[model samples]
Target: MLVYHLYSGGKDSSLAAWILTRLGYDVRLVTVSFGILDNWRFAREAAENLGFEHRVLYMPREILERAADMAIEDGHPSNAIQFIHEKALEALASLPEVERISDGTRRDDRVPLLDLPKARSLEDRFNVAYIRPLLGIGYRTIKELTERLFVVEIRESEQLEKADYEVELRHLLRERGIDPLTIFPKSHYQSRVLGWRGQL
Candidate 1:
């Protein structure tokens, strides 16, 4: 079976897709862009390095604007990020050719975590199975997996060129005259997938 792995050019999603491919699931990487920024280009480059065919999925800019406003209102980004992530998941849910979809969200990832009820609703509404292979795995194991399987680049969130929604959401916040640094939690960092170490 084929699965659409939401690619962010980041280590977690790349690892999820890698595992799926090893299990004989044909996987295509898709980067969701709100059209606010061209960060999807970074994702595409990482996808190429990982040897998966990649494509861009465009979502409405207004949805991001809403998320930005919510973040500013709440003085934090957790709910807003989860909202944007679900929207991105829903955007990917409608592909007629795909029956399964996956992402990099893990056990301890609070922001952007898809709760069971919402996940089931997405599955029920779209008739697609939302598979999250990392949710059952903890942080330390994921770090170990990335260490063994990937060449990675790490940087502070805004400095990295990866396609994680946080990058675009930060841009959206900047557009609204609120510096993303203020709304975002301190000490945030991001990791981009440089390439796989070798075939498993």
Candidate 2:
């Protein structure tokens, strides 16, 4: 069976591909670009370094924006990112031989109801299975796995940390004796709140 890893050339995505490869699966890596960053190039280079087949999908900025707008209209925050993710899935599904899709989602990625929200349920909507084998691990665990598997290490991007302004606002509010959830609730994007929400 052929499985494609939803690759972003990040630590988690690379580690997922490594693990699946070790398990004897034919794994390919894919990255979707919205023309905002060079993430697609990174993913391609990393995949080549690991000796895995890689593909890039360059999506139009307008399509991504409209997807994000529709997601928010449907009451999903940070719908832009989610829209991009789904678009990536769709792109992967169009490939000639892929049968399943996997990503580096971990259990530590908990963010209330939104992280695994019904909105991003690819299995239900796309009829394709999305797997997260690292669902119960932490960042440290992913690092350890990468080292053990001899996968190339990826540098963390500061842009990822700065992607969500409201989350930073919430952290500041919490220091002043305010519960950010009471003010903003779980409205921020999953990419923002998933890391810090449980820590708070």
Candidate 3:
């Protein structure tokens, strides 16, 4: 079966792809862009290093605008981020070759998490499996696994601007004369994989 893995070029997603590949599944790495500047280049590079076919899916700016509006309305971006993720999965589920959707979400992930109700809803509506291989794994284990498996460049999330969907939304909010800090929580972390060393 084909697994469409949502890739962010971050350690978690990359490791998730690696795990699935080792399991002998046909895995394709997919990155979704919000019509803003993004680190899709890094995602492509990571996919190449992992020896997987990579695809970039562009979500329209309007969709992002709606998500931003949701954040504005709800007074937090977590819900907005989850909305974008669900939309991304829906887009992938439309593909005929995709039998399953996967992401690098770990047990500790809060934002962009697919709650059980949402997962069940998606499965019922799309007839595709939504899998998060790292969901049962803790943050420390994920970090250890990534370090053991790859040579990575860990940096602050701001340094890797545009690497996240929220970046685009923040920019859009700024353009609209709104303060992003009013919506997004302070202090989020993200990373990029420079290369993969054979498993230690």
For model 1, residues 35-78, the per-residue Cα lDDT tens digits are 87898999999998888999999999888888888998999998
The runs of at least 3 residues in candidate 3 whose Cα sits more than 4 Å from the true structure, single-residue gaps closed, are 198-200
TM-score of each: 0.96, 0.62, 0.89
In candidate 1, the residue pairs with backbone N, CA or C atoms under 3 Å apart (3 or more residues apart, or in different chains) clash, namely none
Model 1 bad stretches (over 4 Å) = 198-200
Range of the 10 consecutive residues with the lowest summed lDDT in candidate 3: 155-164
lDDT per residue (tens digit) for residues 1-200 in model 2: 67888776656666777778878888888776655555466556656666789876666766555654443354433444445565666677666566688877667754211256653565556666667778768778866765555434222222233222233333434555655455443533222111111222
Task: Give the lDDT ranking, best first.
Answer: 1, 3, 2
Candidate No. with top TM-score: 1
Q: Which pairs clash in model 2?
A: 107-135
| Residues 1-200 of candidate 3: C-alpha lDDT, one tens digit per residue | 78999998878888999888888778989999875775677788877876779989897888899998998999998889888988998988878877899998878878788889988998888889988889999978887898888887775555663355767778888988998877766676668776777632
Report the number of the highest-lDDT candidate: 1
What lDDT does each candidate get?
0.89, 0.57, 0.82
